[model samples]
Structures are given as structure tokens and as C-alpha cells.
Target: MTDENNKIRVLLVDDHPLVLDGIRSRLEDDPEIAIVGEAGNGEEALQIATQRKPDIVLMDINMPVLNGIEAAEKFAELLPDIRLLMLTMHDSREYITKVLKAGAKGYILKDVSSSEMLIAIKAVYQGKTYYSSGVTDILVNESSKKEVPLTDREKTILQLLAEGNSNKHVARELDISVRTVETHRRNIKRKLEVKTSAGLVKYAIENGIVEL
Candidate 1:
């Protein structure tokens, strides 16, 4: 009763029953956190959140009935007081961008240690923005590259390169010839003022084009 009032109420959202179970196992015993409710999809999350009115919602990025991003928007609209923290396997810069722009207070990878998860939840519950270490690195890299001028094709080739994809792979993926890939690489290097492949990779990361 009094203890429940003292704890941070959390609503768990995920599609897989096993995942919800796993999260429950990790968080159920924490004195600082209370598992107020569980929802299998975004719509369910909203319904439960309305009823439960949790302090923070720990949500997954992917789900069948409604994706986490869309649900995040809804949460912003209908439950503006409830903070959102995303737990997911995706570490893509694109996903991070969308989720942050959609109003998630924090984003942590699914593989983080339980302690880290608790840290994220409490941080958001306290009104601070939290991001997984990898996501943080991506964001830091982006700010440095914000001044770099890159074309769409050039950025695509650089991304594949940073991923350690050989020119052949980039060629096939882009449906362009290997020679064309080489040409684009040369152009990117020239534009970025880099002299080597290692330099290209460094620039790619600095430009926020690489996925963590």
C-alpha cells in the first residue's frame, strides 16, 4: 500500500509472452519499481495505460497489432504524463531517430544487463533522457558530421562500406556494377577529403551513417 505508492509504477509492453515473462523476472522484485500492468501490443498498451496510469512505460519497438513507434505517438497524445522508454533489439540510427522524434524518453537495447535496464527506467521516471550506449555513440557521431555534404547515393555506398561490405556486395545490393561502386567510393572520399579506406570508415561514423 504505502510501498506501492513509493515505487515507480511501470507498464510493460511487448508482443511476446516470453519476453514479458523475462522482463517480469528481472524487474518484479525491485523495491523501486512496480510492474503496474502488461500489454501485448500498442493498442492494449494504451488501454492499460489509461486504466493503470503508470509513471513510466517500458515498451518494445516491434509488435503485430501496433508498432511501438506509432504507439509512442499515441502515448504522447493521450497519456502525456506517462514517460516512455523503449526496449528493443534494434540499434539502427533510423529507428533511434524515429523513436526519439516520436517522444520516447529513452531507448535501450534488449541485451543490456538488468542493472542497466533498471537504471534506464529510473532515469526516465526521474524525467531524464536516456539512450543505450550504442545509440549515444551514434548521436555523438552525427553532430560531428552535421556539416558534411553528402548525396544520397554517396551516403548509401559509404554506409555499406562502413558495414564492412565489400564493393561487390554494395554493387549487387544497389544493382550497380562493381566499377560503379568504386567510382562512388572515390567520389565520397574526394568529397569528404579522406585518403584511405580507414579514413572513409572514420568519416562515415562521424557522419552518423553507420549503424551501431
Candidate 2:
């Protein structure tokens, strides 16, 4: 009963076949969604995504040969237009931060109901970000404690640093000079009240800024 013109093309990427089947079955009930393809691993997922170019990809965290984090990073580079919605069982801050930094538009737990999944997909497709209710408290608490709020650019720099990217690399990627990167690094450390790079990374990982 789906309308061909209105349906949102989707691609499923998870290592577990049963997980793919369950998600496909749940989504097929919606008239606005269409499962265009599926992949059991990140490599296969990348292939399907490149060929089918789905509007959304429901990615899982743990997978063989290029986990969801790596796949998402590549996908963002190759298919900038395709939005990624992470659908995984893990809600750990490390997993959440890593995937988001990899360019995912949303994150939702596997325990999410069918309706919630649909809402997440629609929100990401519309260029908005979504996070499950259980994880919202972590974000809220972190946001509220900021005596020194970071700018978007600052956050980007911090995220890159937490990913273990070198200052030179961060500068090149962000189109800033090494001196500037260092300055931002220092400012970020001071603002977060952290003394070392390890401390910064730890905070970022715990706060969902970087993956585990």
C-alpha cells in the first residue's frame, strides 16, 4: 500500500540477518517507507549504499570488516547527501559519541518501538537530528554545566581531537592553521577544566563526543 512517489528509500546495514529482517518487517508496515536494500556488513553496506544511494541508512555499531563508525565516515565522504541513522543495541556514551562524530544524523536504541523508528527516520530525512529519550539526559546535563560554552567550530575541533587526529591533520581538515588548532586545543582544555589531551579525550568519550 505504499505510494511510489512518496516512499522514502531506505537501506539496512547490520551484521545480523535477523536484525535486518525484523527492521524490514517493522518498516514495511508504514506506507511512506521502502526498504530498497540490505547489507550484513559494513563493506557490503557501503557497496549497496553506493549503488542504490538510499535516502537513509539504519546503521548498526558492531560489525565485521569496517564497523558502522568507519562505514559512516566513508559514507559521509562519498555520499554526503545520504543521511545516516544509527540503530544499535548499545547506548554507551562511547558508542553514541563516536557514531555521531562519524556524521550520523540520529541515534536510537534497538529497543525503540516501530513508531519511534519511523519518527527518527523522518526527522533525519528532513535534516533534523534525533536522539532517544534515554540518552537525552546525558546531553542535557552536559549542556547545563558549561560555564564556558563552546562554539560549534570549537566542538568540531574537540571532536576531531578526541578521534586521535593530529593537530596538523585537524588543521588541514578544518582549514585552520596549526597555531590556531593549538589555541583552540588550549581553550577547550581550559573551558572543560581539563589539563591534558588524555583528559579531554576521556571527557569527550564519556560525554558522547567521540566513540570508544
Candidate 3:
């Protein structure tokens, strides 16, 4: 849908300068794509996006100040027609699911070939979804498993535990008894099939319930 004067505008967001350079180099010469702007973090991304209002945003998941998932939520609210395409190193089901829920239209790995990356960009710009092989594999694998849903309380406790909060700290924050927190923790372990606190923390981080 590129006329001689009109092209698809894209904003690139990533914490690393080298990664931004690589993406810029890949898409700079394209006839139908315009490199409108770039941001090093999600907070900067929001500012640039609000000012530039690009048609698509290629963003990384992990960034300082603000994560891409949270930024994607704001982007959805600020720019309804803007397409959010995730370009990240994370290939877990949790990250993908969270990004999609946060209003991302596509997810692709950072290691993909330039051709595949371009294809993903074009697809998402054209109102379609795209996912890298690694992302699709994680989704398929998770779908094949017997997924266990966590309750709201368990999720809260898990997030607190992952953030290095003690039982007493969690109890105080939630206004619940320490014994109740312990019970939730035990139940979380049993439901998640994790034996130790470390395992619980790892699970929580990997599943997008909490960040490292």
C-alpha cells in the first residue's frame, strides 16, 4: 500500500544501540518503509511514539525504566491504530502471551534473519499477526501441556516472592496473616510443581508473573 510519496512509518525501540543500528540498517533502504524514529527504552518510546505516531512499533521486551509490555498497554490506549510488533530475545510462552495481551500484534525473536524480520514487519503493518519459530514453538509446547491456572491471591504471593519479599513482608503488604501467606506459598508450590523458593521465583519470572 505504498504510493510514491507515502510509506509505512516505523519506530524502533530497544535498549542497545547496536541492536537499533542493526534494525535501522536492515530497513533504511526499503522503498515502502520509513524509519521514523528510535528510542532506547519504553519510556522514551512512549514519548517518541506520541510525537511521531508511527504506523508500527518494533519494541524489545526488557528495558530499563519501563518494560515493553507495559508500554504496549499505553500505546494501545494512545494510538489505537498503531501496530505493536515485539522484537525481543525472550521466546517464552509467558512473555509472548503477556505481550499479546498487552496489545502487541506480533512477536519475533531478535535472532531472526533480516528477511524474516521484514516479513514480520510487513505482516503486522498490514493488520496480521506474525511470530518467530522459537516463539511459535514455545506457544505450541505450552498448549500441549496441562496448564495450571493460578488464583489471584496465589499470583500476588508469587509476584511478591519473586521480588524477594519475605513472608512477613508479603503479609504486611497484603494485610494477611503470615500463616496465610505461608499457606498460599505452599499451595503455589504444589500447583506449580516447584519444590523450593528459588524454583518458585524462577517460575514466576519465566511466566511473566514477575520480573527479575
Candidate 4:
């Protein structure tokens, strides 16, 4: 649990051992932050997260088993209380937008200074979102762009619901809370403007949101 005292619990996830070592060396001395665990990929990160329950996950983009954005989607479903912060080398607007939509609460480039990193960690730990200066500019520019109707995760849940899977079944398959599944169902309904299970099926079939 991130609750082992009042210190902020953090998990460091990156494929490069050097990167992990660097972050560990830097943050390990901070009394306010506890490095709960480390993972080399998204799958391992998820496993460790279940065991450690970090309050914030500092993740990278590229990984072997599962990428960070996809993992962020899963984290959004499974651990809605935890915050995600992407610290990667990717600075393109496209990457930034995708990670934000994937449920990252903050994005900071790898080149960020250690001081700023500390500030960002503290900020998100306190329930405030943080983005590095360059990322802030990208966010401002992307603020007006409209996103697609449903995220990949939402479409997956929609497919399950349309396939006659109950919320409990969907939650079990997705490894998420039933309440989280219900929240997604409500959002899928509102986004697709459908009020019934039949309506969801029809929309899924018509829009090809599901393979059927």
C-alpha cells in the first residue's frame, strides 16, 4: 500500500536499468518519497503495482511486453486512485496527446531537471496535475482539439457489454473494479448517446466498435 506512513509512494518503470538506477539514486535520499518498486516493462509494472500499491507511477513510453500508454489505460481501469506521470524522451505533440488521453495525469520529458522532478512529484501527490514547461505548451495547443468518441479501453469494455457480459464479468476479465466498469458503461452510453443494452449493441455493430 502507498499508505505505509504519510510518505508518497512511487514506482519507477523503465526498460533501461541505468535510467532506473539513476532515478533510484536521486530519489532514494528524499525522506518524503519512497521508491516502492521498479519494473522493466508495463506487465511487470502492473504486477508490482498490485503488490506495492504506489500512489504515483513514473513510467516511460517504449517497453517490451506492453507500452506505457496501453499500460496507463489498464491502470486507469484497475487502479483509478493512482496517478500516472509519463517521463519519456518523446516530445512530439502526437505522443503527448495520446498519453494524456490514455489517462496520464502529468507528462515530463526525460531532460527535466531533478529539482523540477521533485516539484512535479510533490504536486501530483498533492492532487494537482503537473507538466513540464515544454509539455505545458503542447497541452495548451492541444486543448481545443477534439478527441475520438471512445478510447481503446472504452471500446474494449463496450464490446464486452454488447456481448452480453455482465458488469461483474467484464470487471473480472479486465481485472478492474466493478464500480470502474460501471463508470465506463455510463460514459460509453453518454458518449454514444445510447440508453439501453440493445442500443449499445446496435451502435457497436453499426460503428464497428466491436469485431462481432
> Considering every candidate listed, which one attains the maximal TM-score?
2
Candidate 4: lDDT of 120?
A: 85
lDDT of 2 by residue, 70-157 (tens): 9988988888889989999887777876776677877899999999999999987876566778655554454434333677888899
Encode model 1's per-residue lDDT on 161-195: one tens digit a residue.
Answer: 76657799899999999999999998888888766
Candidate 3 lDDT for residue 21 = 98
What would the TM-score be for candidate 2 when compared with the true structure? 0.69
What is each predicted model's overall lDDT from 0 to 1? 0.84, 0.81, 0.82, 0.82
| Pairs of colliding residues, candidate 1 | none
Model 3, stretches more than 4 Å misplaced? 1-5, 145-212
Winning model by lDDT = 1
Could you tell me the C-alpha RMSD of candidate 4 in Å?
11.1
Global Cα lDDT for candidate 3:
0.82
lDDT of 4 by residue, 1-212 (tens): 34457889999999999999998888877778999999999999999999989999999999999999899989988987788889999988778767766777678999998888888888778765567888766545444534449999998998887655779999999999999999999999899776655456545544655443
Candidate 4 backbone collisions, by pair: none
Give one digit per residue, the lDDT tens place, for model 3 in 74-102.
Answer: 88788777898999988877787778667
Over 4 Å off in model 2, which ranges? Answer: 1-5, 142-144, 149-212
